[model samples]
Target: MQETGSADPFSLSGVIPPTITAFDEDEAVDYDRTAAHARYVVDGGAHGVFPLGTNGEFPLLSGEERDGVVEAVVEEIDDVPVIAGVGAPSTHQTVRHAEHAESVGADGIVVVTPYYYPLDHDAALEHYRTVAESVDLPLYVYHIPSKTGNALSLDTLDALADIENLVGVKDSSKDVPWLAQAIDAHPDLTFLAGSDSLLFPGLEIGCSGMVSAVANVFPELVVDLFEAYEEGDEDRARDLQSEVYDVRDAIKYGSYMAGVKSALPHAGFDAGPLRSPLRLMDEEDEEAMVADLEALDLL
Candidate 1:
């Protein structure tokens, strides 16, 4: 299979973590902590660092805030590709964000489907097509239906695979069969699993790699699983895959990004609170995370 990013040295393969955006007490963007977190994950073994994704709280950030986060991570990400999240409600916004990400030296951009208003297949196709055309960098289709309410059918994905700039996709839909089918159908397209739960099954189904949120807490483990799978060590891959789900469940404790952000403090990185409207973890939640980490021996 001609994996989407195979031609480029900065291929979007292996364990890529959508890094959390740290904030200060006043909920202001903390570039220093954000950059440190990026460095932490890369040093921990992430092949790529994604900023301003769902875990990074993109929808809640302002123009300056999001751009700062992207630039900060780009500065710290030395060799690994900084695939910045530039999804927005409109094509205009998405295009501008993609342009800005490119301006700040992001290796590529991941654009989610237009949310808030449901679009039919043709509308969705046109939207993605326009964004890919507007930017010079490689674009990845973020097929996360649960949040966006816009799931691309396998047929739509088939069409997208032909686009010159549409290089890869991250499947968060949780449909293993669909992901496998997409991978088989578009042998050249880069198929990346979106959640930690899909890590093992996705690779089994021929996915090139994954964009795991839990990789924030344990990058080495995620990288180990990918290496095991690539080396044909199914048993070791299964073991690491199981460990990742435990980490994923632990971080999914509080509301939205709170779990991951809260869990980072124990790993020696104090990822600040979630943005407004997204509540922080309470003391009880903290205790649960502590217990979970203790059980996992990650503490």
Candidate 2:
């Protein structure tokens, strides 16, 4: 599972969602079902698939379960790179996960900034530096301020830019100006917008692409936007952006995964319930999402 120094799959740049790991009624990882979903996504048109990410409920899964999910995804996906999400509160444990991912043949490791304890810019930089040095494979710095409370400051990114193993980043902060700043600071580094709706805006600001959650439900829509933008079809791209805005308004808020998972059973996918402590959608919320999807003919 060691990702050698062949080519950096960490050079992420597209609508690649950290996929939702589907489980059966018994709350077990549905490897066959999930792998089929992975194939569905690759065929639907996405640059890659990320397993064991925040959306995949990384914290809820045991290390062995995480490895199983990664292995299943890698097996299903053809050329689509699988960037394994290996973030944790402990740096040592995070590095261990990263090394495990590398050992399991993952294309790259997506390490989110450690949360719980508020670490300053230097400490944040050092945490990433330590993980990057721990493995020879490329690293993708995941910056989600709302979740981690440890934002990747412009100064910190500037410092980490010098690390050879740190190839790119997926910024989920939703701070467009800050994302722009990261692109400005490191013109060579890959800056992927973690927000699906911001793909066009990120691209306009020189961002390579996105690590979107919506792509799990609407891969073709996001991929269409990227294709249109690349083809210089601004009108088509703008229309896709409008679709994202509408979809985000419907399902991106509150228990987003539950909303999406609720929609899945309707879409002919047997997506089971969410794990405990995280409840599934209530009647009212489920109705709203279904209505939205129905309006779009997605359900």
Candidate 3:
């Protein structure tokens, strides 16, 4: 594991899959299915398992459900760290989530910027500082402005990297130059590109890993891609990276999150249904995705 210092034991490096949280027909959290999928990814060679991120429908879950999901994941997996998502709209809630994650045995916590209400640089800085102080666990800031509507300037990110116990960030901003800037500025901090489409480009610069939604369908694909890139197999890395984009493109043809949820069952996981307001792919589109998976020999 790569460490920033003696205080940092958990490395947020390698192809970490932000796994899906399964639900039953009633939309309740299905812990067994969720844990099974977590184990599946680990057995498929994921460096770590990230549950309840955007792809896991974190915003859709209640705090209690979040607790249960993290607990299930930790108990079910073997040998890899579990970085649980503790993103909330408020700092207090985020702190609570982080505390609960630690209490339930999560190896680390990922805190996305507070959503809905945009904050100035100072407020955002204080927000992370407060949460970091509340927990002893290693923390990774999740910088995904598209969903959270709060972007972290390079200065803000540098400041966060300086915070005690805040070790790294997963940049979903999809801005390669900006991510490159963060990597260059904080050489001690780990930077993970949050999109599969940018995986090759990010690695070409200095990203240590990825937090990919598409990894839900093929954990091995992302793992292989990361391995190929790390081993200096440029041709294999490029080919695998291209394959990731193909699957990601298929998933995005439908609702971004829903497309992933829909693919789980086809991939042999029991992902019940997409939570409300997130519709499933239409029959035709579903067939197309299945076809895409078939073409990739993923099914």
- What lDDT score belongs to each candidate, Candidate 1 first? 0.85, 0.79, 0.85
Model 2 weakest lDDT span, ten residues long? 1-10
lDDT for each residue of candidate 1 in 198-220, tens digit (9 for 90 to 100): 89888877677889888888888
Local accuracy of candidate 3 as per-residue lDDT tens digits, 170-252 = 89999888987777777688788898889888888878788888887788899998899888898999999899988987777
lDDT, residue 246, model 2: 84
TM-score of 3: 0.96
TM-scores for every predicted model: 0.96, 0.92, 0.96
For all predictions, the C-alpha RMSD in Å is 1.6, 3.9, 1.9
Candidate 1 lDDT for residue 71: 90
User: Candidate 2, TM-score vs. the true structure?
Assistant: 0.92
Candidate 1 ranges beyond 4 A from true positions: 1-9
